[model samples]
Each structure stands twice: as C-alpha cells, then as structure tokens.
Target: MTKPKALLIDVTKCIGCMACYYACKEANKLPETEKVEEDLSATNYTVVKETDGVFYRKLCMHCNEPTCASVCPVKAFEKTPEGPVIYHDKKCIGCRYCIQACPFDVPAYEWKSNKPLVKKCTMCAQRQKEGKITACAEACPTGATYFGDREELLAEARKRIQENPGQYINHIYGEKEVGGTSVLIISSIPFEKFGFRADLIEKPLSDLTWEIMSKIPNYVVVSGVFLYGIYWIINRRMELSEYNKSKNRDSSEDKN
Candidate 1:
C-alpha cells in the first residue's frame, strides 16, 4: 500500500509571507479583492497570522479519522486513502454539519452564494494525482511547509526537535491530537499563544460521534413503537364511541 502523504509546517521557519495565501487563492480560482481579510473565509483557504513575534499558519488539519466526514449525513466529506479529506459539493445538502463537527473549525461557508458550499483545503489532491505538491507548499519560498509521506514527515519533525532542542518546543502539534492530522506543526513557542487549540485529546473526535450515532437505531425503534401504540388506542376509542352512538339511535327508532 502507498504511504499516506502529509505536510509539516515549522512555525519557526515561517517569514509571515502571504505567498502561500495568494497561491491558494489563485489555485482555487478565488477572486482577488482589493483588500485581503486577515481571517479564514470561503475565499481564503489558508491564512498566515503573526502573534507575539511568531507566525502561525492556519488551514485544514485533515484528521486521520475526520469528524467532518463522520457527521456529514450526505457523506459529502470523504477521507481518501491518498491522504486528502475531499468534499463532494454535489452531494452536500447545505446542512453545515461538517463545519460544526470539525475540531479545528477549518471549514467555512459561502455566505455570499444563494447556494453555499463548505470550503476548505483539499491538500491539493488533484495536484498530487498529477505528481505535484500543493500550491501553498510550492509557493513557500522559505520551505516552512514541507510535504511528504506522513510517517517520514513525523520522523523528520522528531529529528529536528531532537537535534535542535532549544529551537522548537518538545511536542509536535497534530502528531496525536484528534488522532493525528495530515498537517503537522513544530513551533518554537507554545501553540496556544498562536491561537491554536491545545485542549484537544489524543483520540479521534469521530469516535465520540459514532458512539452517539450507534444508539440511533434504538431511538428509532422505541419511537416507532410508542407512536403506533398511541395511534391504536385512539382508533379503538373512536370505534367504541361510534358503536355506542349507533346502538342508541336504533333503540330510539324502534320505540318510535
């Protein structure tokens, strides 16, 4: 089997350049506005933010077991074997379930469109199929964002941390958080300082959702039986009332 691919982002190496941002916009065919929004939006698949002299890049993490894929009733989001969590817009029902289910809050809705679709990074699946890297990674001049096999990238990140202990924090963000993401980050400072959520557990978010969903069949069965009993009781009462009324009417007619 082919090894899954991944992206390793070293926050210390980033220069706060918007090359990856613009490259994402151009690659996704999004319109270039006069002014760029500093936050992630439908048009902006990736954004670079600088806080306290440290630059942090934000985009879809693409979990190994994606909660977005789990919560999507229409199965619009799919985690492909090749490594990308791809979205099929045609199958989407505009429910926004995936947006709510994501741990990183990555997916954004198109508020401007009459029929909006959830938008986020695809890890350049099409480009990968063509033996090319992601546009963002390709446009990165400083090589902050490195793309390769997931395991290989993990090894590289560990080596960098081990070799230069003073340069980066001991932990590799996204290494095990939410069951390991396709995108990994190694930062010099604490991740929480850069607006990254550090409260997430190591287990996959989808597991919790599946535990709840597993009870759905039981819920349906109990509800169905309860509703049927109510209907039956009402019908029986109505039939008894009609029979009593008919008997009274016959007695009156016979007396007349």
Candidate 2:
C-alpha cells in the first residue's frame, strides 16, 4: 500500500507571504478577486492569518477518520487512503450535515450558486497520485509548509522540537487531535493563540457518530411496531362502534 502523505507546517518559518493561498486559487481555478482573502470560504480553499506578528495557514485538516465522511448520509465525503478527504458533488444531497458535523469548520457551501455543493481543500489528491507535491507546499518559498510521508514528517517535527527546546512548544498540533490529521503543525506559540481548537478530544469524532448510527435500526423497528399497534386499536374501536349502532337500529325496528 502507498504510504499516506502529509503536510508539516512550521509556524515560525511562515512569513505570511500568501504564496500558498494564491497558488491554491490558481491550481483550483478559483475566481480571482481584487483583494486577498483572509478566511476560508467556498471560493477560497486556504487562507493565511496573522496574530501578534506571527503568520499561520488555515485549511482543511484532512483527518484520518473524517467527521464529514461519517456524517454524510449520501456518502458525499470520502476519506481516501492517500491522505485526502475528497468530496463527490454528484453524490451530495445538499443536506449540509457535513458542514454541521465538521469539528474544524473547514467545509463551506456555495451559497451563491443555484446548484450548490460543499467545498474544501482536497489536499491535492491528484498531485499526490502523480507523485507531485501539493500546490501549497510547492509555492511555499520559506519552507514553512513541507509535504512528505505522514510518519516521516511526524518524526521530523519531533526532531525539530527536540533540537530546539526553547524555540518550539512541546505540543504538536494535529498529532492526536480528533485521532490525528494529515496536516501537522509545530509552533513557538501555543496553538490556541492562533484560534486552533486546543480542547478537541484525541478520539476520532467518527467513532461517536457510528455509535449513534448503529442504534438506528433498532429504533426504527420499535417505532414501526408502536405505530402499527396504534393503528390496529383505532380500527378495532371503529368496528365495534358500527356493530353497536346496527344492533340498536334492529331492536328499535322490532319494538315498532
């Protein structure tokens, strides 16, 4: 099996150049606007944000067990073995379940389009298949975003932290959050300072979703039987009322 690829982002190296952002728009053939976008949206797959003179990139996490894939009833979202979470437009029912279910709030709906679909980063799955790096990683001039095997990148991240104890925080973002993600980050500052969710559980969100989904069949069976019982009782009462009415009419006729 092909090893899963991942992106290792070093926050200290990022200069907020927005090269990756522009490359993503160009690679995806998204519309060009007059101003640079600072937030994720249907049109913008990636964004660069600055806080206290520090730069960081925001995009889809491409989780190993994606909550979007788990919550999508129509199987619109797929977590590929190649370390990308891809969306199928044709399979999407526009239920917006994925948007609500995603813990990272990465998925965006095309509200302006008449035929809208959920949009997010695919982690350049096609490029990986072609043995090419992601567009964002390619465009990164500062080497802030490095792409390679997930395990190897993880080791490299640990090595960086170990070599420079005072330069980086002890924690590695995305290493265990939501059961690990393809995108990893190491930073001098805490992740929560960059608006990253620090309180996320290490457990995969999909596990909880499956737990609820497993009980659905039993709930449906019980509900069906209960509704049928009510219907039967109502029908029996109607039949008895009609029989009583007929008997009274016959008795009145005999008395006359």
Estimated TM-score per prediction? 0.85, 0.85
lDDT of 2 by residue, 54-166 (tens): 89999999999999998898998888888999999999989999999888889999999999999999898888888889999999999999999999999999999999999
Query: Once model 1 is optimally superposed onto the true structure by TM-score, how far is the C-alpha of residue 255 displaced, in angstroms?
Result: 34
Model 1 lDDT per residue over 16-98, tens place: 88899898898888879788768778888888999889988999998999989988999999999879999999999999988
Off by over 4 Å in 2: 218-256
Position 52, candidate 2: lDDT: 78
Alpha-carbon deviation at 214 in model 1, angstroms: 2.3
Output the number of the lDDT-best candidate. Answer: 2
